[model samples]
Target: MNRYFRLCIFFFFAVITALPSQTSASWQPEITIGLSQGLSGVHLSSTSGVLYVYEDLESKPILELPQGSELNVRILRDQIMANGQEIKGDQLIIQPGADGFIRVNHAPYRGYITLLKRKGLTVVNHVLVEDYLCGVVPKEMPPSWSAEALRAQSVAARTFALKNRKRHASEGFDLCSTSHCQVYEGMSAEMWTTTEAVNRTHGEVLFYKGEVIDALFHTDSGGMTESSENVWGSSVPYLCAVIESQMQTQPWERSVSLDALMQKMEKSGKPLGTLKEIRLSPLSIGKGSGDRSLSGRVRSVLFIGTTGSVVLSGNDLRSIFSLPSTLFDIRFRGGEVIFSGYGSGHGLGLSQWGAKELAEKGKNYKDILLHYYSGVTLEKLY
Candidate 1:
């Protein structure tokens, strides 16, 4: 062998050895999803679609256990397993399933479950809350929640699940908890609408380092959510708006003549309307962009569904806002952002309306996640 060639081979191996080993296709099969759903069944979000079922434990009903049974079992933290599915972990992250709530471990965080006695069975129902709306699922979840926030959550869940289906895997879901991504919990079938949103936005995709990542999701925390990447520092999406449409259309909106407004330009020849109003709009107003106010002779247009206010500057007839790459049905008006943005979550990654669409579509929880988020995969952690 040539001495030079041997040296090159050694150098090549050294570089290869220094690189991180890529993860191969995972072969872990699912064991079981654990949650405390009774005959009423539980719900789990999946790429195939929304699934519902129930399962109960053969062990003592936490509530009805004969006095002595209570002694055998203890309420450690506020959690209990359901459907007789044995779980060995600090906690189980359950998806409401067709047989019952499916159990999987993401991470033991916060929230509580209900335990009571009815007849001979010990009733256990885990009220899992994978903080979909607020910031990282806090241990003490706020009692009062915004219906709109929940809707964003449904969209996130569906988008996440749907992308996994495209990956063509059979058993496992992407971890839906922790800061690495958003959190999820299947406490009831009522959230089926949430899953429907997932299926509707199917086949959507995204890439990291050009490799497909299971899109993690979350509900609206104001107009902010997690971002895929930043300065390589944060692990969440920053506050931004997902534009849905263009062409501002409204009989009333059209009634106000832009040409006429331009005709009213100042004698100095400067455009009269310079984003004339500093008014406010609904946080996520799909109602014609937002509220329009009169600032002197100028028109101040307020936008809905954003974290904070941004001023987009242009020569004329333009609206600017920051977004990832794709432009989904968002309407932008031309001007400079005068206000600051607040909170982080998907303004449009999962629209509140989108969540309602999920529910109306008859999609289960899993189905909802698969719809909105694109390009990614799902895995289950036991």
Candidate 2:
């Protein structure tokens, strides 16, 4: 009997090894996004069919509402109340029927809606990663852009979402729906073009040395991108700076009065009373100098004032003055400090405008991605 059992086990192993490897369709991972937080109450409705409400971890539906039915959820002390009735649990999951979508405060969203009472009522969306991207790509980039550009944006967004999946874990979700995470407007933001891009690049991600990359992106890169070390003070091999050969410089200018600057400094807890002079190196593109990054972005600035002088980083200045970018020249004129800069964002990773230019020049999405993210491989995770 032992010999027969061993033979059966050997045969089972052989059959298993002989079968082809495949990722199951159901293996698609879901991402939870914090839609709203600290809400006293929220309204929900079904868009197409019935909506099933379930308590956390329960398969059976606790409440069901037909089409057009509305439910009001609120928090009282530590309890969850729905439609004037107190729910037994602190969390409630709302799932839609076939081809149905749930609307939270009139904004329709794909996948299940979860309401959790943490401090106050929090609304979350539990959506498949791909479905989430459909809402993201359009908001991050114009849906009217080239197909390849859209496709590239899709991959980058997906990789970014996956890499930062636990960014808001302590806040009870994977990410937020604002620009702090990725601007996600749910079903309302989905477009046919951008959705196609997400579908075409489904399960695709940018990987560096077997791991997914952060895949940071921005609005424009001016003429050159900055190294990760220069921007975030950490060296990432795959995030090395690259020059956009076909791209032209995008220049911007802003001015702030010295008095305004002093007030801003005081508000920021760094009281620089009566600004006397601004000392910064002249702006030079694609080269690093003292107080400047390799991409010519201001790394630090020496702010001289009458009361006391304090040196501030370029990012701090950007926040204080609402400047477009850190790559700028500071000049004192009359009662105002003029800031003339290039680019629009942090000047790291993929530049959206640069991608559009490349796509218009006949480069595919892969080419665009490779040009921005050095030494990375595109892999289909699913």
Candidate 3:
């Protein structure tokens, strides 16, 4: 096996075997994520404990650093050193203080940290997976929502984290602290409600055929959830279309000037010179009438312009116009193109608003998850 693959395998085994079982007891799995990049230097501190600095994952420490002593790290061509000492070898490991936080650039992260130079910057935050979820839950979904909705979001986020653990493996980390993975604000974003949700659903994940499924979610679904085939072209049985609620008409509208629309079209490489007219396939309120997805989202559109006409997919239109979703109708009126639509995000997986509505009407998080995800079982994996 290659050196990197061996190292990853070792790491995975270390994490998995470190725990007695997937459930029954809590396992503090280390999740390394890229926090920021292009940073020339970083400042770190811990409140208590004998902070040990190590070269990579070596047994011997380079320095048994003291607590509360701020270490300002600077990156050289390859090595990152503090106190004019060559501390970085392979990677730099900074163990956190006991029951305390590791302060990075003054912001505190609730675990030990590993610093590696990448693209001329330090990258890596070795945090406990549960602690990482604490940072992610609130930012991904509101803490004030119904308890069941928050719990549903917690399970979804946890499943997504574990399933996509190697999403940024080439970057020397598991995930990124942004929407690219999950919006992990670390410590500051944690709230009581979200924390409770995470604890209650500890180690729980959505499973399909005994493996963790991609528990994708969004802000709202308008009234109906979208199928994975319609959005990403790969259909997961659990991500099929469903009417989220009986009450429809969650309206959202946006208007852009003809010039703005043309500029966007030009930027997208499909320059329709002077705008002539936009022809949309007929659409209905719920069921897609013409050239629309089963959930009523636009499938394709024809842009007729003075220079040339271009046909674009609904996704392309959404991207160029900055529309909330593909489920929209285009109307040209008085030198402006107005897009009227429902929904906030891609409309796949569990909808936060839909979950809230269901929770309010006596649905638990498991029920909400099953309703949105089709056939799936919730399994507790410590």
Candidate 4:
């Protein structure tokens, strides 16, 4: 071959090698989510095809039911009973055939179902990570929000799920299907807009120093976000406090009578006689003081009473009173203790409302993500 032809072949091979590998293109991880626990019985069905039932430890399917068939699974002491038939194993896997989804108690799920016997019958959904996010994004944020905001939520939710994949391992699954993990409503909750966002940012995650960061997020930040050390008591470099470009505060107020406040404190195991006064600095946004975090969220409050006194953290007060957030001002007026606050949820990482505002202002998903999670690189891990 001529020298020019040899050079041409060399360049073509180099180009082929530079392209993404097949493994990367097809990389998809499965996530196991605990749907419900402590159930005496659950009804199972398939959307469009046959359902195959198998033991968790066996490869061969034990039973198969036609499309539109229903099976009632119940716990019989330590064994599982399917449609009154006693199954051999303690765990049973219900898989749908063809392009179908399995329904647990009339709710459609993307992947197969695993029914395990714990304290009671535990139902878990085994779904692909991307498909899981399709359910999560719509539930976490409004599906009608700007495309960029949905995409940002997708990345954050994906990173969080992959990072905390083993969160509920002891419970026989990876994560739970509640807000405590990530509110996953299965295929029924998947929307076109959110699914599109998930597809656009497929396999993308936020990484700090080559490791996936715990992408914690919240509903709204009053004006600024709080650091990990402030909210969770551990300093995470990427989870630092960041002020929103457009500070849109969500104001809220709740009033409890002095007698009611005392009763609440007593119910929480801290008995203060008669409410005296609440001591804390004034509300200062983004300015840390002795009693507040950098975002001005209460660090601790000195609760004085006639008989005894107690110092409670802002989080403590929030739990005690069911307040929206810890960023609040406590004032004693008349016979009541009034709590005036701003924002919802624990102010950490990405602010959902803040993301929506930024997206409306033409900021893309990457820009929104970097704005909240500091010093993180957006990479397509798959």
Candidate 5:
């Protein structure tokens, strides 16, 4: 729309994100990253803390785990079984069923273990019922598809985590398959290839001296890729620009070039194709990021500006969707937004393009990770 409107939306996101979450920070730990395995009852546990599962009420089970999947399990709480049984090492095996659940090897659910959950989620890393997204690939999906992309995702993410272990630089990287990144589910025919994708990527996000220098990826949403610095204020060496044809096929086309968008805007007053109303204020940060993609991609409402470059986030999104507001450590300067966003991510940290670039270059998964996440190294939790 107008430049004033864009500025208003930018300020809105900044203020909203800066505010406190409804739940205290202590209640929710920082960045609970959950790894979704296609199988039921099994999930990757990252970000040492408690776990919570995202499941629907009807299908929700008190205890849920994945079957045939292996994840390191550590007990956070000590419990004496009703039968007076004491567990050992505060650790339990995570056994899942084909139908989906964490099969309790020891009755009375012995203890609690820290597991990885989605971003901006609290309630001690737990299970995701329906949110554990897994579905068949569109019948129209290219025949060349073979779960290769998702496998690459796991490998890249894991590699980044591994190499950056020494410095604990886990900030930029995120768990894939969530709305924030890729959608991974091992069981579904669509996501069956995630394991192989990970094998291909090797979870390595390369970095220089602890700073994630490179990591590129592609999501079904971001019709195009993004520049990491523009989003997270850091340079992701490999993600300079993503080509259009390489864009993933998702309902929402994220890649909008300023030059190309200018043509569309010149004909139509709207800069973006979605044209969703947004609130540009800092007051919208902690309103539960409702109806949002699990990755916190949805905000009340906010506007995108026409400018050289601006970092976008969930809060900023509020301005476009007519949501509330928030204040964060980000700044949005309006120029000619020109519908330039090519991806749906916060556009920070690790990018899909950067990941693919590394993968193509024969960089092992771990080596790729070290290139992006600065000052970190890998350590197998198992």
Candidate 6:
């Protein structure tokens, strides 16, 4: 009986080993990020594990420092220098500590980091794609939200990161930790719920025609979402208008003087001498008419000024006024521009609030993604 049981166990192990593993080394690629720029120096420290610094692309590390060692890096005469030693290479790679975190200029980050002297400063914080996403998920969405919602968010964020990987190529980094790219807070913003969400949907991304789509998202969609052509001047097949019943009504009211409005426009490079009259053409919540998008979001508005009347898109007006969204009504009354609007953000792709509501109502992450991004397939890239 014992011999038969051993034979069965051996066969089971052999079969398992023959099958392919999803998370192979080649699938998980390391992602480079420029954490901080325009810095002539950086101070790093690791307490738990030995920090290895590589000055070249060689297999062996040049400096294997002890734990809790504080190292300072600087640039001198257009050459990289570390700890007062003239390093040969233009970059230095610092491996993460045994605790899986490294301190860069007092802030902790997961995975390895590379320091490079570029232009007038040092570029810091290069990390793996998964480690970077762990910091991004919690900062982008509430960690306490439904698991399904967070999981959807994880996939969307991952897709966005991969799609825009070369956004900052000229700046010597793939992406920045700001709204321009994706808000990454590093180890300081790590949350267990968000981390689990990222792990649950690891390497999963939304793809259209075998290419990763720009998985844009926003806070709310008011009543309807807009197509990509109307909002961003590109007609994307998957980013079509759709009504979101789960989203609540969000109204925003603001008042600004005509002088202030003119000043704002001037700062935006559109110098209108003086404001005369503001006309707003109204459209239905789900229908576009005249200068509005298919979802009734403003596409363009005519601004009557003393010098000359200039036409601007609703998105442009939103930026000048710091409004939440382009869906708004404007009226010039008593020398003040009274504006009232609904929803928030660009109203382009997935609605984060809509996802939360759907998750609460028993919808899974996959369902939420399909509802927002139509005609797209969820693929496991790594």
Weakest 10 consecutive residues of candidate 3 by summed lDDT: 17-26
lDDT of 2 at 265: 90
Report clash pairs, candidate 3.
22-382
- State model 4's lDDT: 0.86
Could you tell me the lDDT of residue 260 within candidate 1? 43
Enumerate clash totals for all models, in the order shown.
87, 0, 1, 0, 148, 0
Model 5: runs farther than 4 Å from truth? 1-144, 147-151, 163-192, 200-223, 246-315, 318-343, 348-382
lDDT of 2 by residue, 1-382 (tens): 2434533553454334221111112446677899999999999988998888878533677788989889899988778998877898778888788768889999999887889888889898888789999999999999999999999999999999988876898888889999888999999999999999999998888988767799999998888888988778899988887888643478888988877878889988888778877789887787788899878888999988788889999989888888888888999888898998888888889999899999999999999999999999888776
TM-score of 3: 0.90
User: Where does the lowest 10-residue lDDT sum fall in candidate 4?
Assistant: 17-26
Q: lDDT per residue, candidate 4, 201-273, as tens digits?
A: 9988888876678999999998899888987888999988899875538999999998888898999888889
Q: What TM-score, over all chains together, does every model reach? A: 0.27, 0.91, 0.90, 0.91, 0.34, 0.88
What tens digits encode model 1's per-residue C-alpha lDDT throughout 210-314? 333444443332322223331122443321223322221110111223344334333324344442443444333222232211100112343222234333211
Residue-wise C-alpha lDDT for candidate 6, range 1-382, written one tens digit per residue: 2434533553454334221211113335455567888788888877467777776545577777788787888888887778888887677888755654678887888766778777745555666678889999998899999999999999999989878876887776778888888899788899999999999998788888766789998888877888998877888998888888743358788899988888888887778798887666875688788888777788888888888788889888887778998888888789899878788989988888888888999999999999999899887765
Best by TM-score: 4
Candidate 5 per-residue lDDT over residues 1-382, each given as its tens digit: 3434533553453334222222213311122223322112322331223223222223333333233333423222333121123333222223233223332222111112222232321112122211122221121122233343343345444433332222312431224334343333323333344434433433233434334333333332233333455445566555433323333322231233345544554454445443323343332222324333222233333445443222335444434432221112122224223222224334333444444555566665555444444454443221
**Where does model 4 exceed 4 Å of error?**
1-26
CA shift at 295, candidate 1, in angstroms? Answer: 24
Q: List CA RMSD, all candidates.
A: 17.4, 7.1, 4.8, 7.4, 17.7, 7.9
Kindly give the stretch of ten consecutive residues in candidate 2 with the minimal lDDT sum: 16-25
RMSD of 3: 4.8
Off by over 4 Å in 6: 1-24, 97-100, 246-248, 266-273
lDDT of each: 0.29, 0.85, 0.79, 0.86, 0.33, 0.79
